[model samples]
Target: MTTALDIQGLRKTYHNGFTALKGIDLQVEQGDFFALLGANGAGKSTTIGIVSSLVNKTAGKVNIFGYDLDTQREQAKAQIGLVPQEFNFNMFEPVVEIVVNQGGYYGIPRQEAFVRAETLLKQLGLWEKAREQARNLSGGMKRRLMIARSLIHQPRLLILDEPTAGVDIEIRRSMWEFLRKLNAEGTTIILTTHYLEEAESLCRNIGIIDKGELIENTGMKQLLNRLDTESYVFDLASPLEHLPATSSNLCHCTLLDPTTLEVAFHKEHYSLNQVFSFLNQQSITVQSMRNKTNRLEQLFLELVEGNKA
Candidate 1:
């Protein structure tokens, strides 16, 4: 499979002597939905900016779908669609006009751009607001508009930087579905987000940067499997007073509250069934249980902290 994006010895240093990238290398195969995650100032946005040609790279070879950024700049850029963290379009413009205008930058025929705009707007649930001024739409609608604009050219690769920020859960989930469909239709996507859970749910492969360096890059499932333990929170049907004791060192139980308990266990040594059995023995009844979504967050913290040290 061809690589959708490849970075070799990428480095970036600003005029203020602030280094944003530390010669980090990264790759994403064509058609893969990948996540580029990091805390603020970790160079995630810088890497993206360089790839999209919005920022000059200090030193590196960047190849997008076999087209070199420096030598084949236009071809490489033509393959990409970037949705930045902020809304950059004119708020006073009609929604359809805003989307179609983005296509003008790529030299797409105005008539064809209108057709593409219609299709994307309908797909993104923005058809009803197509004629409305952009500023009249809700925050989620504005985010969707950016996405529609990004895809106007139907580029092969799409880069999203915090695409769902500030969106309500319902709208965010809908956007997730739309993105999933886009990826399924063979558009390579690289997402950068502060929402760890969003990354965990949507991305197949992951790269985490910290302190201006890439600290971890691996398949999502593979990285998750490396985790030594998993934790779950269970709400009790009745009040429970104290931490529950476990027979094996593999299991650690803690009382989160009078009616909430948390259980941590080694994967090979314990299972949810065993936890249920143990609780049965204690005459404890569980009202509900949820897997703590912190598995990725936990590993992310470790890798980033390790990089710092």
Candidate 2:
């Protein structure tokens, strides 16, 4: 597969000697829905900032479609669109003009810009308010507008920085559907969000970063499988008078609720069959038995906690 975005030994450090990003290497394939996950103050924002040319990196290389970012800034930027975490447009400007103006800055002709702007406004469900001042729009509307503005040049790679951060559920769902459709249409998407469930559901690949370092980079399915290897959740028949003590052989078992037992074990040593056998021998009937899927949230916690340790 062709690479849409490639980073090699990427590093960033502030003047005061604060390291924001370590030597990180990553590749985003063409038309991929890639998710970047990390805790606050991790290099997530810095990574996006460098790719979007908003932040200067202390060192490293970033290439977009074979074009080096620093050497071919214009061409590289032209092939990418960034929807920042904050709305940066002039609030006094009309919504349609704000989008059209962005196209103009990209050297797209006025007529073409107008056509694209109109289409985007309508497609994003903002056409009715196209003539309204952006300041009059709600927060969700502002986010939709920013997305429309970023696509004025129709870039192949779209980087969304916490795109659904402050939006309501309905609006976030709408944005997700829109993004999914765009990905299906061959646009590569790189998203950084706190919503791990969203990333697990939408992204094919994921990268976890911590304290400016890349901790894990792998296929989403594989990462989740690592978490599921020997984990199980048992919906018990009822709350027990005394909790079942886990032996050293049993690994870790946590009581998530009165009726749920979440357990994790190493597959090489333990199996779900063993769990069932033990429960059966104890004559404890289970309401349900299911694998406990590993999530980005859990992976993130592990990363941060490990770093602290």
Off by over 4 Å in 1: 241-243
Best by lDDT: 1
267-296, model 1: which lDDT tens digit per residue?
A: 988878988999999999999999876788
Model 1 TM-score on a 0 to 1 scale: 0.96
TM-scores across all candidates? 0.96, 0.84
* Alpha-carbon RMSD of each model: 1.3, 3.3
The candidate that achieves the highest TM-score relative to the unseen native structure: 1
Model 2, 1-309: lDDT tens digits are: 899999999999988899999999999999999999888899999999999999999999999988999899999999999999888999999999999999999999999999999999998999999999999999999999999999999999999999999899999998999999999999999999999878987899999889999888899888776653466789999785555776665477778887888777776677778877767776667998876764667766776788778
CA lDDT of each candidate?
0.94, 0.89
